[model samples]
Target: MRALHVITGLGVGGAEQQLRLLLRHVPAQCDVVTLTNPGPVAAGLTADGVRVIHLGMRGNRDLGALPRLTRLIRTGGYDVVHTHLYRACLYGRIAARLAGVRAVVATEHSIGDTLLEGRPLTPGVRALYLAGERLGRATVAVSPAVAERLRRWGVPGRRIRTIPNGIDAPLFAHDEVARKEARMFYGLPEDAYVVGGVGRLAPGKRFDVLVRALAELPGDVRLLLVGDGPEQETLRRTARALGVADRVVLTGERPYLPDPGDDAPGVVALLSAMDVLASPSAEEAFGLAVVEALAAGLPVLYASCPAVEDLPPDAAPGALRVTGGAGAYARELLRLRAAGPGGREAPQAVRRYDIAYSARKLMDVYTAALAGSTLEVSSP
Candidate 1:
């Protein structure tokens, strides 16, 4: 079956990565369209032999290009149009409907106001989006938290389908030699305990808070930050001011996985090198990175927000979740680091999140979406 996948941009993020993974494994023919033109994700699509069209939208609600989008969808004759992210989901679904596609679907990777950190969207905009969200043949929630949030916003539970995000398990499974080699490449001290944080360098992600936590640790503990974003400079300054600049390694936007074997084993290796994974995201949809760390057999000290706490129990063990505030985070760091069981063996807690298994579950979602069956959101 022919399908059209629409997204905001090709920049690195969970939503973009999810599309990349879906493109690699979806059991159907697919094409991608980027409303904000091409970026890193475009290369992934091209590598997959999937056609990617760039519409070059100048700003939000740029209807000047709607006719072009409609023509392309009609000409492609796709049976399905699946959208990711807020802007694309809003406009792309309407465009797909206008093109008269048989099915339209959207995956809400994070809650609606993730940009606003769980706050309600402006009343008018919320109403408008609530109506737009219901336009789809099916709305997929990447996690239960996201689905429940949608329900609170007036979207019927009947229209929401929860699908937890999946990772390539083998990609995150532990590797000792590779972990050492990765640390050596970064000139990290062999005996020093490492703490790593991965994800976009944005305010909501709270990378500065991670730096603060790193400063609270002893000198032997170093912090490694993967990925890049608009707040890179601000975070760099924070590290410098916190007097941990020398101990911080910022590998801006490193490869997700150097070898396809683990999708992005470099990340896994970094996780293996850490005594603990610190995910201080104030808001997260599914905590994919936390799950990856668990799969790598590393314990996590993450934010205790509903999104992170609501993750399946199978993925949460020996996990020190902090819910209070900055002081709470510092206390947790001190507690975990003092009794640090630095990289040892892969924990048995991660088996349920195996990539192959999750991929199979996702395939079922694709099959159901294609067959027009409504999917139910499961309880966390």
Candidate 2:
């Protein structure tokens, strides 16, 4: 079936990268629509031969883009219109309904009890989201925690479906040679014990907690902050103030590499190079990077990651949920280092998130939506 996927922007965030990976495995013909800033991720989609339409939306108040998107959806003759992120969900659902699309679905990638996009979940925003949600046949949550949050927000239980984000497991498998190469490329000593964190450098992510935790760790232990955002300068200053400036390496923002084959030198390589991964964010919807690190056979110490917490310990043997506080994280780092330099192999449970498996599950959702059923699928 022909499908149209709409998102806010094509930046290198988790939701955008997840769309890129999902398209690779989905058998149906799919096209993409980006509201604005069709950045690097758009180029990757084009290279893969997918059609990406950019709607030049000036800002949120730009109502003109609504009619434009509606016309495109109607003209494209898509069987299903799937939306992602905040702005896309708001506009795409209305546009799909206006365009007379029978199957409308949206994936709620980021939503928490306290915040939505780093801001408080005000009542006004909740009202608007609930209104928009009614236009869709189903809303897919990336984790059961997210599904529970949706229910708390007053969405009916039948309207929500839990579909955990999938990764290309084998692509991130640990590699000794690649690990050495990644360390060399980043100018890190081969023996340096690295603690890495990947995601948007935002206040909500609490990357500063990692900087503080780094200060408490031994001098030889280094911190690798991947991705970038408004918190870059703040994190840099925090590292400098804490006297660990030399040890903290901020790689800025890197392109999202969905399929990192054995030799691809992007995120997968960075994950391979790290001894252990640390995610100190107290608020996380899914923790895609944590899962990717697990796929790369790196042990993860997370403070508040719903993705890993929802699973049993045996499901992700390498993941450990630590309490909030830099000292707590520092202690965990020392304990992990004492064991070994490299992380343990990924558990067999990680295979549940394979992109192929997710594609099949998504097809079921699409089929059910087309058939006019709001039945929720069992979580993986």
Per candidate, the number of residue pairs that clash is 5, 0
Residue pairs in steric clash, candidate 1? 169-355, 171-262, 256-264, 257-264, 297-347
The runs of at least 3 residues in candidate 2 whose Cα sits more than 4 Å from the true structure, single-residue gaps closed, are: 256-264
Each prediction's whole-model lDDT (CA): 0.74, 0.88
Point to the candidate with the largest lDDT.
2
In angstroms, what RMSD does candidate 1 have relative to the true structure? 3.2
Per-prediction CA RMSD (Å): 3.2, 2.1
Residue by residue across 1-380, what tens digits does model 2's lDDT show? 99999999998888898999999999999999999999878988998999999999999889999999999999999999999988899999999999999699999988878878666889989999999999999999988999999998888889899898999988888888877987887788988999999998988888898899999988898898888789999999989999999998888666645345423357877888899999887777888999889888899999777777877767887889898689889999999999885535787777777888888889999999999997888888
Per-model TM against the reference: 0.89, 0.96
TM-score of 1: 0.89
Least accurate stretch of 10 residues (summed lDDT) in model 1? 112-121
Report the error of model 1 at residue 348, Å: 4.7
TM-score of 2: 0.96
* Model 1 ranges with Cα > 4 A deviation: 112-120, 259-265, 305-308, 311-315, 342-351, 354-380
